[model samples]
Target: IDVGLQTKSNIGKQEAADRAVVNLETRYQIMNMVKDFVRNPANKNQMIPFDADSTSASASIKAYNELVAERIKLGSSAKDNNQALQALDTQIAAMHNNVVSGVENAMRAMRIQINQVNQMSANAGSAMSAIPTEEREARALYRQQGIQNTLYTFLLQKREENALVLAATTPKGKIVDHAYAQSHPIKPKPMMVLFLALVMGLLLPLLLLSVKKLLTTKFSTQDELAEIIQAPVIGEICHNRHKSQLVVKPGKTSSIVELFRLVRNNLQFLLTNDGDKVLLVTSSVSGEGKSFVSANLAASFALLDKKVALVGMDIRSPRLAEMLELQSLPGVTAYLAKPGMNLSDIVQSSAEVSGLDVFVAGAVPPNPSELLLSSRVNDFIDQLRAHYDMIVIDSAPIAMVSDTFSLAKFSDAVLFVTRANYTKRNLMNYLNTVMSRGQLKNVSVVVNDTNPNVSTGYGYGYGEE
Candidate 1:
């Protein structure tokens, strides 16, 4: 309502200012005509070109026309030195000066009126700014009154209902049996209690296990995950028995390393492009060891003497540098944000693995998705492709944020990571939906942290032992 009132008021003010401007323009036209008459009296028309629409200038134009007509008649009938003609010339000069003064006065008045209207508009705007707070208070009061009214109505109805029930109710008493006292106590039979206890002990374990199985929402095995997702389970990584997150180090032959090697092989087969391959490694959610998988997988590829560039694309929560124990230097974000930054300026060599360069996620940015959405990100990937053979991008979880989806377009293939017994089973259903909709390109799954016993059947220790 306040806004409507302000708008209506401003419209009125604008119309008033427009009228003043029109009146001012009419005065200017009158002044110009009088000046032209003074310059060329003979050619000046006896009937002035009067504007019927200009009410403010009508009287002045009439007087000027009369002066021009008297001068024209006297100049035609009498000598140039005649007194009447001279008198007419003096009157016409006075009228011309008057018109000039009127035009200047009209201009000044119009300026004053416009400034007044602008001041009023400023006042109205100030009032409008204060309306929101007043409106909020009014609405709050209205809501409180409505709540009270509803509560009072409900209580009144409930009171009337109770009164009606009381008026129609009847008192009746009946006894099913009389209270009695027993001579012996019941509930303390020793042999019965012992037998029940033994029965409960026998059934408790089975009941607990059944409930656990029924409540299992996460996949506990690789096959359980593989059965749900439409994509192939490229390979599975066993649970790392060691404390260090990096397992595929130099001169290491652990089962985890061997499994990563297998995963690496499967990824190589999936990306069949002749030149550089861009692989996006992400998970349904965090804490699924995607960073660990990314670091180790890159190491595994580096072990094959392939030039691998591991980029930490997860600018939201960058853990790749910390996990690799590398100094947190400027990385992909710098390359995307700064035009002068080169790949060598941000790329740091991995001390733990040779032939592998780590691109830290750089400083955590506030707008990670927008940064990745930049066209420079594609150029950054192309730069990596030109330099390295394999570009492994460890991105954010697909289910949690949109940063990965923006990076997905630049990848040749996707390596979706899921941890066994840690990742929810429903995530595979979501992944299947993503694959069906073609949101990701050439998608594959890599199950991380599976039970060592379940994964050892593939003979990870074929010749090491």
Candidate 2:
């Protein structure tokens, strides 16, 4: 019934120790004892010494009352100055004779020796009273113990029952276990735990791979990507059919390229603000198709006869340059460090994706954080905005790196990508906070890697064919 059948009332060792540190309260140890007793297998069904035989209850009560009445009457008569005291004496003599005979008969019947009931009652009462005092002393000792001591006691006596219900010393129901309850917990299933651990080890990367599929999220249907982003997607970019229709092999045709072209056309509609056309194609975390979306998006914009600059702002672990096979020569870091360097040297063209230009991050820098926030980088983006009709910047993994925030400032709006299964529920809140607290304008969620299976299709087409 508790977290692992933990009574939750156990005086934890720390709490016990804390008592020792200041006020001495055996409260902690006492709690441990009770918990141990309750959980003990040997005493599991033990009726805690409070159980009474209910079958003979009515007869017992009747007999007890009658006996008490007879005793009081005899005693009062014996003490009385009245002549009836003599008759009481006679009655007592008769009763004593009957008891002696009755006691001898029952001794044989029960195989037990008879003790004087009055004397036994007097002796037992003293012993029982002494027990309470002894108990009180033990509690006092516990109170002297420190919190750590209390915790130690609790830990040592886990699942071992101690006397807890002294006040609740009434007959309660017989509570039992289902025979298979591990007194020595078969729990934390070692194999299951190992299996779960292996699963956990693989979960993140698998999710990362899954999210890397669809880059820019513009649902073909209404709210197709709802599972990823709570924010209303700013706009839907229909599957563009531009140079995407252009045959990759002189005459070969494809619809996949057309799909990206549609995404690019929709992005065009979003860039109405004109001056700061720096588009941040970023996913919630890494592997959410942000790089692919950014690269293809820039290509799509360039195809419209618009001068487009695809800047790899992802200072930390830039993958866009690798994907396009562009020279990872001096790009953002190099050009930004030396503002006087020719932007043309860095502005290398993508060999395959036509009309799209890419600026590689060059070598991995020790200080990517400082590079994005550098004044030179800001001026470079400003300068690029003037030259290119649309400035599509591919930045670092949003969650992993702090670089995106600095680069994001240069952009007018941002498109956030989230992997359908990879993105956790909490990440949506994290993304929302990034935009809300940062006050970054035009932030939209693009759910990526939408699987055709498993997704609940909660408007996000999470698992659509």
Candidate 3:
């Protein structure tokens, strides 16, 4: 609104300035015409020059009076009307008439010039008067434009304010009443909460159990293994309760130990009559108890009065010495490192089983892969092959390292070990790769750490007694 008023005022000022310019132009034109008339050569003599001190009519009258005075003097002096006096009188009258005519002509010319100047001034005035009309029209136009601009600006400002108000003001719903808590407690309904929690407790596990059953890819039964690999599952070893690696004892009987005995019995059918059977026991990954299974299986075979050498081929992380509780040095790595070291010196006897000989991973070598791939390992296996009836090489996991693939060449059979809940279904891809590549001979899976209650088919009816 203020801007509108200011705009109207500015427009009015602009109109006034225009009217002033027009008036000034009109005055300028009048002055120019007056100057032209005054300077015109044709009207130069016609323009009368007036003097306050000297009047033309007065001067002429004074000359006529002087002539009459002279004539009177001459007449008084002469006896009769002489020719000189008449002539003088005639000359005086003619001169007076000429002076009057000249004065009249000069007055007439000045009047005409004055009239021309007046006409020019009138034209200038007329033109100047027209400026007022134009000024009114221009002012009206300016006022209209200003009004439009002001209205537009005002509307825009109002709209912006409305928008700001709309943006700033959040619409709150009508409140019926303010909320206040009751004197008594509303929550802590133990029975209701316990009911819902009980329902959730029951439903949640069932839902998760269904999902796990549907999504499980790991072998839960020996049938699943047989279907996938088309190989005989020599044994399903139950999870050991004891922390010791050698779960099998001489006269001790347990479900886990009996499972190893069952594995030893199943392994007899897979072996060839080729003197010493080299069995490479490995798994897809570590902690699946390949070393444990190898140690126990070697012990199981030893219990049957068969000579068995459990060689720790996992040179990267040698755990057999820890498992067997024997000296790890002067084992495989030591025998390989020193050229003159005897195999008998590095071979240690396990007190757990009489016929079971344990060769631990001597020391961790930087080049374990290269050491496993060397011909010396094959020669060492051959030396052990001549002595031991069964050579159980506890090699590194096939999925983890390439050391197992190299050791698989010296083995007549590969016992691929996998845990029940620990191994995932994706690990089958590694086994499939090993089988497809023929990296291991006669590869068969021994699903270790089997829960007998979960999978009753492979439980062999052994229980904790």
Residue ranges of candidate 3 with Cα displaced over 4 Å = 1-214, 457-465
Candidate 1 vs candidate 3: the TM-score winner is 1
Please say which candidate is ahead in lDDT: 2 or 3.
3
Clashing pairs in 1: none
Candidate 1: lDDT over CA atoms?
0.76
CA shift at 307, candidate 2, in angstroms? 1.5
Ranking by TM-score: 1, 3, 2
TM-scores for the candidates: 0.54, 0.46, 0.53
Ranking by lDDT: 1, 3, 2
- The whole-model C-alpha lDDT of candidate 3 against the native structure comes to 0.71
Q: Write the per-residue lDDT of candidate 1 for residues 35-111, one digit (tens) a residue.
A: 46445657443444432223444466567756766676556567878888888878877876665455445546656
TM-score of 2: 0.46
Model 3 TM: 0.53
Tens digits of per-residue lDDT, candidate 2, 1-465, equal 544323222324323333333322233233234334334667422322211112232233233333434544444435656556555445544543443343334334322212232234334344334335775466557554544565556545532331432223333444585555546766777889999889988997887766863453333332545554556553332322333322222122233344445555555566676475788877667766677677766776776667778888777777766777667887778887776797887888755555667787777778878777778876787778777788888887777877877777778778776555455656666777876786456776554445323332233322112
Which sections of candidate 2 miss by over 4 Å? 1-228, 234-255, 452-465
lDDT pick, better of 1 and 2: 1
